[model samples]
Target: MNESYKIISSSILYWFSQKKWFVYSILIALFLLSLSTPVGLTLPAYHSLIILVLVFILVTFEPIPFPAIALLTLVLQVVLGVAPPNEVASSFMNDAVLFVMGSLMFAIAIVHQGLDIRLARMIIYFFGKSKRLFLMGLMTISAILSSFLGEHTVIAIMLPIGLSVIKNIDTQKTDGKNAVLLTLFSVAYGTIIGSIGTPSGGARNVIMINYLQEFSNVNIDYWKWMKHAYPILIIQLLVAYFVLQFTFPSSLKNIQIKGFKKKVQASDTKKNINHLFSCLIIVFIIFSWFTFNDKYGLGIIALAGALSFMIFGMISWEEINKNTNWGVILLFAATISLGFQINETGASSWLVLKFNDLLEALPSNSFNISWSIMAIISGLTANFFTSSATVSLIGPMAIELQPTDITFALSSAIASGFSFLTVISSPTAMILYSTGLVSTKLFFRVGILMFSISIIILYLMSQFYWINI
Candidate 1:
């Protein structure tokens, strides 16, 4: 009994030590809430503003897990009477949340089938001899696959391929580190750029779609979304390839990826069948998303793919339950709820009103200035916060600012996916960083360059292509 008491005490102490910053953050938020009241804002709007600030700080510093921040957001909303309990609860289970959950499950099933090995073999078979060609192939594959399979899924599938090649390189050589960094960045930046290509590519895209539909009654279907964003994705993929190649030039003329094809061929017949079936299911899902998304949303179609995997016994629920990052799903749901409350309570409009003077100062000739400003704000904010959170905060404001110009508003949201500044900027970057081959400093160093290029590309697209579209 005495030993149990000591163990419990020690556990409590350790938890507090780990979470002290979070505790301080909560206290600071409450203090700020108590003292804050801008004139002409409703009580709920004021409270929402305080909560948004708290969330921004907590998410940026990340003293706790994202899900914890999300739970805190929901709890505070009810406890502070900023929103009704039922409304908050209802907001947490939207179609966007369901889509995230379903897509993650589908991703797990696809990864479980071990098809990426074949994919790696194919990539090497075509581009094994030339350093630049290999890098371009890897990036192109990552971009195209990510546009359909989502960035998290594509990165998870591709990271091991890049890591294996890096591991094969002679680390004693002076150019080894450069080769590894370039390869990893090819995968990382490719996935990041492709995330803006389609609604299923990332959660932020879906969230923006939901917001546009809900707030403006403007429905952007899958093909329409692709048309608007795919050109940017293609150009960015090439730009990332050139930027990575220029920044970290590989000295090796050729790389031999041995045994990948043999390993793929060694898989048994049953495994091959499973792989083929999984690919077909994924393709079918994408096709359906393109053809029938108006009838059945992307979330339901993704869940159907997951279900197909289960019915065919290609993947088990036990495996998915263990592998899935439920915290991310929960975080997305809570953030969506918070965004809804921001809009519902007039907090977003109030915030926009604060910026109205500056917006009015711009020349009245064209909306190019406003579009650039919105894109810059969204892109920069995404570097610190999750892309979904950035959209959740900014989407409502964009809609409030220009209810009729949804094309510009969505362009801003799409550009925010250019999360090229930090490890925490996007999940793809975090996954790549986890490989230990890429350093945080290197990520930022390369990211800032890519971020600048992305802004230029997006600005040009906004002015020329998007306007005509």
Candidate 2:
């Protein structure tokens, strides 16, 4: 009897220890819900506010898998009467969610075809002469590809190239280590900066575009979005390169890439044909997005691209199903639904009003102050939560602040993509962190500098450039 009792006790303790944060989060959410509603607040809005707070805490700490958090949010919306079952269900699926799903599948298909080998050879052939030139070429290639192919996809393709180069280095000295770190970060930061350049680059951009259209009736097409954001992307790329050079100054003057030509020669005819076909499919999808996105929508075009790969036998369904991260897609869908609930229940508008009251006491009357505050908040939040979630939470509030100020709304969303302080800040950062060459401490150290520079650049752009454009 005593043995059984001890076993049960141990099991209970272990479960509690494993889920302590989850329990704590639930308690805090319940405690907040128990409070009396503020003046002029409806019960539904109050309940949604409580759920939103819970989501932020749970998502930040991640006491459970992100998909579970998303499921919890969906259940609570109905269980707590924040929204009807039908309404909550409707929010679970949308164009943004579809786009995320389709994009992930397409990315997996493209990566499965093994085109990275050809890409690496091309990179080395072009930039193999010197260390500095190679770094520049890597960053430029990463940025240009990511601006259209998506940050996660580009990183998946480029990360191995960086790692391969590092592996080929002949020395185990500190200088060699610095060279490896700089090369990896060049690809990582390039992918990150370029993700803001186009709507197709990241899901946050699509979420923000959806929010703008739904809330303000403002439609920013693919071309317009690129035109507005590409300048910032270009400037950030330059800043990132210089900052990396300063931070991890290379000791080597020149380095030669060995056996690159032999590898290029070894590529067989079938692989080359497959790669060329994949390239054509990618080009077609990008062209369609730029030209026909308004009619067929970006999500549908992405899905069609994935279908094209399958139709042409470029990739198998088993590969895509095995490799794709569907949980992320579901999480995005739930957060978007939660954002809709926040807006529908007046929670976002209430928060905006509170923010305005807080800002009214500031001595500066300049609109730049407001824009900077919003950008800072969005950027900081993005460093912790994913950028898509940041946009979902803050996009509505920015629109509520001034629907007419398209610049302010779009800037707030785009600037949130400048998540540089943590590996969890963006998928590109997380992928680079997986390389095991980058320590978390080093990441934060370099990331903080880049974060500061990006914020200042974004603020200045909002003040002068974005305002004019």
lDDT of each structure?
0.83, 0.85
RMSD of 2: 1.6
Per-residue C-alpha lDDT of model 1 across residues 1-469, encoded as one tens digit per residue? 6999999999998988988778877888879787857887888888887888888888777889988888999999998788999999998887788889999999999988887887887887888666578778889999989988898889888988877666677756657767878888888898899889999998888888888888888898998888889999999988888888788877743344564445545667787788789888988999999998888888888889899999989888999999888988988888888888888899988887777767787677346766777888899899888788788777888777787777666776887899899888888988877877678998999899989988898888876897787
- Which prediction has the highest lDDT against the true structure? 2
In model 2, the runs with Cα more than 4 Å from the true position are 170-172, 253-256
lDDT comparing candidate 1 with the true structure: 0.83
Give Cα distance to truth, residue 413, candidate 2, Å.
Answer: 1.9
Cα distance off (Å), candidate 2, residue 52: 0.9
Q: Estimate each model's TM-score.
A: 0.93, 0.96
- Candidate 2, position 82, lDDT: 92
